[model samples]
Target: MIGLDPWSPQAPDDPGLTALLEDARAAAGDPVAALALADRATERLPLPGTGRTAELWRGLAELAAVDLTVARTLEPHLDAVAILAQAADAGYAVPPASGTWGVYAAEGPGARLEARPGDEGRLVLSGRKPWCSLAEHVDSALVTAWVDDERRILVAVDLSHPGVELVDEPWVARGLPRVRSTGLRLTDVPGVPVGDPGWYLTRPGFAWGGLGVAACWLGGAMGLTRRMRTAATEREPDQIGLSLLGKADMALTAAAAVLTEASSAVDAGLVEGEHAWPRCVRVRSVVHDACETVLTAAAHALGPGPLTGEEEHAARVADLQLYLRQHKAERDAALVGQAVADGMPVAWA
Candidate 1:
């Protein structure tokens, strides 16, 4: 009910971003090229928050806007791994932006990275860490390891070093082959400690970074609206189609507004102050639901026709669907609701 234009005439844009998107798109056609280009563009991006770096990066992402969570996850200045480096430097006197980087923190029966002490008291990680996005390609990575049953350690590792082995052809996601994320086995991979422990999640940037992800989701939802509109317009005029288009339009319009306001907050250091967590939870959940609405409306409106018949449209939907799942889902929903009920400062007022 509280919304403005569906699309901002001047959200954020750059000349270089146009070239970067072009290169990125061309590179996306090849897995190897895509990996290299992501790093290249990341390095080329000015440091975050410098000259509207964050806003422009998110805007450029909307240009390609094919719902590619993989490339979006790996490439650009907003990358989690890259942001980790920035956080490390700002919080712990570490350099975050010398080269390409990744964050591999997932753990499980199949995705375990064990940490042990070395003779000099440095951290050494061994075992297999699954979900290492672009692990084989990135120059370095920020990894989380089990220090004990109840503790975890964050370490920075040079991926090219010995004892680090990328499992052969580990990724097979049909929607995001360009991301190249997969399981990797680390056998005594030496690493430098990032923080005392819990630094990764405790930092204010953690929540800010989570909001960055929501920006991507919102951008993708808006991008998908183009196809949704085309799908509705090409068909015989029907109430159902019109309704679906309206739902998709409103959902994306709401998402865009939230993202714009959230981005303004981030730029103003509001997210960096006391409101980080609740603000993050609220924006992520809201944008996540909006994206779902768009996806559903677009699907039901188009029926099985575009999903099965058209390759590009189908690929975008599949990619966005998979990418959207990265959000915490119902857990996040409950947590955000609780925050609001408890009166956290998630509202601008």
Candidate 2:
């Protein structure tokens, strides 16, 4: 894992950024503190496709390497910032430029949050929203609700409003124990619309945001592989250990290569319109496979000793397991295949 840090060569030579990352690593155990750290990160981390896309994603990976939960908390907040900036750029009425934010666009069965007309021509949201992660902690959020039977729009809402209620749902998942992703019950909750109907999903930044999550996944894989490499170095490695190490290195290297290329494509203005969705699917699919490969390899190479004894290692493994589930796996793979079959331009070299 020595030469395998994805951002080592391309990472900016900024001592302050390095120091902030060290601080984030140290404060990984506390979600509240991590939220504050994420707020500070918004000011320093560059937005994707801002000529510093590589640095922005590298910062995310560095955060995940220490703790996936912290990365989970920070990644959404960073994405919310980027989304808001995009909305502002498009002349949408965005919320005040402050506070930690979360993006809650996940739609599920049994819930149908809707937006409708309200006083002063503002929008009001009602019904229930599912999978609102960090709902009780963040100050505000960018949530997607149906504007009509056929259209969905993204709106920013104040989480602390009386109309916003955190539903009591059983969160029994051991992974990411600190970040509770629960349902929100909104009763005529006032919200500021972020963009035109359907703009959120269609925007180019959507793909960039998806790729940012992949960077975190790559980092999580890097974390597990780092431990595997450490154990191999500490003792005389067995044939199986060497084999797993080689397999993991190959997976990580491939994932990193795709991410680097995707970042460049984004900054070079190649990922947009018809290209954005397919590109995101391709990159996420690659990183997700790499994560799964490393997960299996590390488990076999390190055995259950770390799982049973090391708190940090166990948490990292469980957190990454759940985090990677964000990718829809075969369903998403089908999307990539469909895109390819539909004559989407793929620069296969």
Candidate 3:
């Protein structure tokens, strides 16, 4: 008979497991991570109380990572939307399965996807979407389409049904590739209505989603900083080593400060009403700059050899560089300009 001691200190704790636990705890505050965790945990743990606790923890974590204004603006719907979409993709039953929405910068002919309420009160989606993140994994999507007189309408469609095709070409982003962004084609698929036409701009979804992206980028940046520090400490002292060390410290400090400030602002409810758009844009700018700065520093410190090397740190640096492309700095600049034109003070100006 084998005896198991529940309180035995001699029980070995796996270092990898311990590290994973710490990572999960840290990620709990990030909306993306929290949402992902909630989705995964709920799937695995069906117990009602346990599932609720996991969901609560995930929500709390998201709140901790973002500002209250941003959260309030987007959290009401985006959280449920993303999670429900993921769950549906994973073959779970999700109510309100089909809807319509639109995409920007689409490829192929007839780039617009439209949805209209059907006789049975369902939505019929028609159009194409490029760069639909997690499209392949979702059961349905809310797509945007041009209505009468060129007005936009939000429509939802079921991906599992015919007329909905997900292109296998996945978005090759450095981080969060597991989310599996892909192109989607909908040729009159069944769908449902979400909100008023062209309401995506008026809703908090875009802003909140941007914040989630920022959090994920910040996480990757922090991970890179940690790897760089470790590598610097382990390497032989040289000009590259010294330069890398200094840059890592500076870049990490700056990025961390900006992220903290943005998170604090979100948590404090300073992002609502007329101030919402401008504040969100400003935070996006800050995150974009910080991501660039940190990635550059990491790459410079590691050098071309380690950067292209097969090591984990090298791979991470490469991934960070790739992920930075998603920031859309030009768009942020445009938003800032518009805000300034509208009499909002540009923070840096």
lDDT of each: 0.66, 0.87, 0.50
Off by over 4 Å in 2: 1-12
Residue clash pairs of candidate 2: none
lDDT of 1 by residue, 145-179 (tens): 98887778788788898888878654567665566
- What are the per-model C-alpha RMSD values against the true structure? 3.7, 2.1, 10.2
Q: In candidate 3, what are the lDDT values of residues 108-193, reduced to their tens digit? A: 56456665667766667666777665554444455666665566755555567878787677355554334445677778787655
- For all candidates, the clash counts are 0, 0, 22
Ranking by TM-score: 2, 1, 3
TM-score of each: 0.83, 0.95, 0.66
**Candidate numbers sorted by lDDT from highest down:** 2, 1, 3
Cand. 3 TM to true fold: 0.66
Model 3 misplacement above 4 A = 1-38, 41-110, 168-181, 236-243, 346-349
Of candidates 3 and 1, the better by TM-score: 1
Clashing pairs in 1: none
Q: What does the lDDT read for residue 212 in candidate 1?
A: 58
lDDT of 2 by residue, 1-349 (tens): 1124552333447777777777887887677888978757887789998888977888788888878878899999999999998898888778775888999998899999999977875799999999988888899999999999989999999999999999888899888898898999999999998898899999999999999999999888888988988898899998989999989989988888888888888999989997688879989999999999999999999999999999989999999998998899889988988888888887782
